[model samples]
Target: MTHRTTTGTAAPESGAAVPAVSRTDLPGGIRVLTERVPGVRSVALGIWIAIGSRDENPDQAGAAHYLEHLLFKGTGRRTATGIAEEMDAVGGELNAFTAKEHTCYYAHVLDEDMPMALDVLADVVTNAELAHTDVELERGVVLEEIAMRDDDPEDLLGELFDETLFDEHPLGLPIVGSEESIRGMSRDTLFDFWRGEYTTPRMVVAAAGNLDHAHVADLAAKALTDAASRFPTGVPVGPRSGASGLLRPRRALALRSDDSEQSHLMLGVPGLNRHDPRRTVLSVLNSALGGGLSSRLFQEVRERRGLAYQVYSSHASYADAGTLSVYAGCAPERLGEVVGVVRDVLAGVAADGLTEAEVVRAKGSMRGGLVLGMEDTASRMNRLGRSELDHGRQRSVAESLERIDAVTPEQVSALAAELLDVPLTAAVVGPYDDESELPGALQDLA
Candidate 1:
């Protein structure tokens, strides 16, 4: 959903073992990788094309997304309805998504239906009619999606942060382009983008669970053999030159009209890029900050202060850059105190630093969580594919844990200091207008 393309970071290939999945180059330039995970009844296959919102020029806003919809409307061999019915008949779940640097269509199905899933997915990507009629109808649906995001307070605020952070870059554009751009989109424009972006060499076909090298390779050969099309080499993506935000103090309030029980407040700042070696250290630091019920923000804000029902911190690193955010929900009456407790914990970590015991607990939590999560086939498959996308190859679970273990308390403390040093950009979605009374409202931290 978000584009994380960054420059100078190590391509994911740096630390990864050659994946267990065998890789092959097909006729059209598509690359396929497959691995067999035994004893699972289901198979998961992904068609990952290297096109996302970040590739869009401002003029083309949601063209990639529009193309994604047309892919399923009708392929040469399958009608739109037929595509859906055939998959459901076999209890197969098919889905697709657009992100900053990739568009992925995936399926989870009984092993026997793997071939069927591939045929359907391949057709959707390569043969959609993109007829004027289908395009016109879907445009309305997409517009409604745009409206929904604006109404969703928390989501809208994050979008605001991204927009402000990457003002002139493609990263600032929403995945679902503006209404004006979507309305202007023509079938030909959709076709041109697809023809230029979708190709065998630029694609990744990854399948895991109840599948083998032969089956995956065969599927890849059939679906991707004809996908080759070439374009000029891309110029590298650049860093965002924009400042952190547009929310001026005593200006218009960034509240949303949600009649829900609690109000949500979110604060964030730039963090690190995906390939940064200290990512593991950042991870440990994030967990200690507000990752769980036992986390510092949770302990101070929710348990002790009894202001917020929830509070958590997260760090997201992209190829080009990263972000660290803290989000919380609380009653309107308690918002001020909730903000105070959160600030206290943040300031405490940034100033005094994480204790030896705290760092150990965070490390155990992060490393232990990784080992426990890879047990499921779907999780394992996605982990591999996303890691490949973000980092190049997948790190073995043991290797991931080793990195976590190597993160010293000093590293975490240092990262905590770095992340908190910025003047925080805060977005609160609730009933308040001009929340000048927020605790720790002054931007200073550490």
Candidate 2:
């Protein structure tokens, strides 16, 4: 998913003719959310499940991602080829991904073909066969993906960073399990994980773009009736909750030596969760620090020094824990200077926040990004689905904007002081034999 700053302007007063959003909890714990957007012929539908890599035990590592692959191979009614043919007939898109806290299987198609899309999605999510033959075939594909990740310097650095920061927590593990785990996994093991985790209570169905709430609800009802009957009755489970206090700063830097001209390193610290009110403040601060071309990190690291071609800062928030990280890929010999500038900038921010002018510009950038992101049906649908699954309710575009608007420079400064004051954890990948051989400043990282 693309990283977006979701803050916008105030909404129109009540009684205005605006897009309509509706929610319903059908029988058997399946909840549905739909938005009726005017003047578009397309529809975006998503089935979001509240199970991800973090939910797995050490033995079940990668089961969620594996299931994502196998489900598209074939369902009870549609063969893998048949599924592809059906999607092509309608000129539709069908894809899915697994994250740390959840997985989403989504499709985009013309509104007229909504019924077919819903039916196919229901069939795959609810009735996947998970056959032994399919399992063996996908195993090789997953191994190849792992190999590909290892071959990329930035990707490998990212994995090392997470592992080092999160330590022994499940959040520390890679979403795609190691080669040993993937190769040793059995068909029965995946089947069992699927049966327990893929319940209706753990799912949300969200739709947007030229859709009628009642009509889409009916279509969904008919499609999922059989699957609903199979599910046990209870209140739907909410999104991933609670913080992993285990995500403390690492004492020793994690180094992965690679034969590359440029060194990829991330300097990060633990941050707030999704429910934290400070998240809004964090967004504003992140935009000013490294969210765009004009950000502090980009301007100082690239424009002033001309040390590297790419430099940026990013923030990731899970249920309870989060991270603020700065990434820079520079020549192996220039790594020390790049790391020094970043450390100094971060220290300055922690000591004293951004200027009033910087804060105003950052807020405007965030607001523009939020408004523009809502212009497309796909982004709108994603916002609805993710909000409902992660937050248990949806905030109106206006509401979200108001929160961002309410943020003060004081709030941002305080948040920076609290989060950035902690010791930094670093991950580096480049042409170096070991930590001892790295630059002097980087070697003492703690």
lDDT against the true structure, each candidate: 0.71, 0.85
Q: Residue 37 lDDT in model 2?
A: 78
- How well is each residue in 90-192 modelled by candidate 2, as lDDT tens digits? 9999989899999989999999988899889988898888889999999999999999999999989888988888887888899999898899999988999
**Each prediction's Cα RMSD?**
5.9, 4.6
Which regions of candidate 2 are displaced past 4 Å?
1-19
TM-score for model 2?
0.95
Listed in order, each prediction's TM-score against the native is 0.86, 0.95
Best by TM-score: 2
> Model 1, range 79-193, lDDT digits (tens) per residue?
8899999999999999988987678888989999999998788888877778888988999989988889877766776666566555556765788888899988887788888
Off by over 4 Å in 1: 1-19, 229-261, 433-446
